[model samples]
Target chain A: MNLSELLDNRDGQVYRLLFYDCRPLLQHILANYNINDSQREYDCIMDFYLYLRGDEEPFAMLTAIKSEKALPSWLKTVFSRFMARRANHDGQTDYSDSAFDKIPDDEEDSRIFTISDLNTAITLIEQINTSYSAPERVIFFADIDALASNRHSTDEIISVLHCTEGNLRVMRHRLKKRVQQTLAKLTTND
Target chain B: MTDTLIYKYAYNQCTPDERRAVRDMLVSDFSECFAVVGLMKTRAVNDIESSMLKAPALALAVSPKERRKTLEKGRRGLPDVDACKNAPAPKALPDIAYDEEMAEMSEPIMIKEQAFGMSMYFDEMPLQPAPDFLGILNRYLQSE
Candidate 1:
């Protein structure tokens, strides 16, 4: 069941093409996050693979947002998106509700820090981002991923994004607020 | 992990931060490190299996009933728990305010809008990206 062999299967074919086409995107994203944890990166890539298999939303955005001038850069835009999502942590924290009693500062809850937890965190972030405008969400997540990957300051992000510091602050504020709300929901569900 | 460390360490090309990181990884992951000599001795650049080892090599789509058969043939890869025919149903996600919408969204999804007396496909992108779209998948995957 090696890659060379799996290339014969439909899923394998899709993965092979993906591996070829998105190598740079994944490499850049990999350099930023999950470099120390290759397995987690693998799982994240596999998740994308399944979606490619499914022909599923954001995936089709590549074609949906097609315009002659924008077509070529669309792939880069999409890569920026997921790379942002994967790095959504951005050193953010939410207040734990009393309903979810305060966890002791005990040993690590590896389960809570596992790859699945990160997946759930990503899901919650996406759910919260649903109401935001497309451009806003893209900038927000990409900025967040930038923070995680580059450990950049607000000043740096503002400069890199060619946006004002006020705009960056507002984006960070909105992101943190959404993260808190999502954490509340996850807390109740957990 | 071992291969990564060995390559970085022996080359002496690591940045100060990377050197610290490698030290930390070594302290934290002693057991997972490969034997430096043995790994080098056995590894050949021409080995396709070695190069593709980290790639999603196993391509499988099987009902639980057939999973056992597959396992009988080879149990070397990551075990797919859902492949077991008799495995218990996945626990339902606890009902939250948006539970129904979330559950419905677990399926293939689309966002449709009617505007200006017409059905406008605003952000009507599907997750089925051609040539493997990553960001879109993460967007939809996180939502699911």
Candidate 2:
């Protein structure tokens, strides 16, 4: 059936269809979090479900959507917002908890960071270097540089840094964790 | 995402840091670049469709590809993303954060400066006409 028909469902079949169609995307989002408790996980899912199904605004937004293919990405943002809201409600302050800490500010999607904010984040990231040879600073700046120039290559990075694939993986994981910590600090300090 | 935010992002009208943050999201998060692109596409298509609906004759005159190109080019008043990387460091504006609230509050006061100033002459002196008047008139008439 077309998106219009799916959207016109009166028996809540739309949510069911959406849930199944976007299950993999939702599952992928959830997998990043470290929610160990089954009950909390279920609660998060149920809350997100209610958010989508109960809100008139979300439904209204859905009406403007022309393609079913776009729904997954649009819903991805919705699910992301819900996750941020859940994290905020939980009152979790520690950045070491899980992947949820990656998104420290619930309003990050809409937040406009200034150059000063980027500089501050960069400084904090640079400070997190565990060793002189560590590639966090290089990698972070490299990625940002790449964003502008559209020239990022893993092979180039490895060759320049004289690091192996295994070492690069470990360093990236470390850098990711540090970046999360820096992001959390930024939100709190602001 | 808010319409303004989506529009700014899709049309490259947001600040450098704002663009960087969104790009960082794509890189650091769940590889949702494709999905994010889809979302942006939805917003863009809605805008294009609405404009086409408003002017069916104009829409018929322009091919879809040409219309899309015009939309992207016209709406993007800023430099391209590649140019942004190489552009000189932006001289810092006032320290106030450019949040949504600030945007709303400042909207009334944010007057754009004219690119050219009015001609200067003595009050008693007759106004000397500019050499480029005919060119300017032609350009203005063509735009209309």
Best by TM-score: 2
- The two-chain DockQ for each candidate, comma-separated, is 0.02, 0.01
Q: Which residue pairs clash within candidate 2?
A: none
Q: Write candidate 2's Cα lDDT for A118-154 as tens digits.
A: 3343334323321212134344444433332345545
Error of 2 at B106 (Å): 53
* Interface RMSD over true interface Cα atoms for each candidate: 22.4, 24.7
The C-alpha lDDT values of all candidates are 0.36, 0.39
10 residues in a row with least lDDT, candidate 1 chain A: A106-115
The positional error of residue B97 in candidate 2, measured at the CA in angstroms, is 52
Off by over 4 Å in 2: A1-12, A36-39, A91-190, B1-144
The TM-score, computed over Cα atoms with residue i paired to residue i, of candidate 1 is 0.22
TM-score of the second chain, cand. 1: 0.22
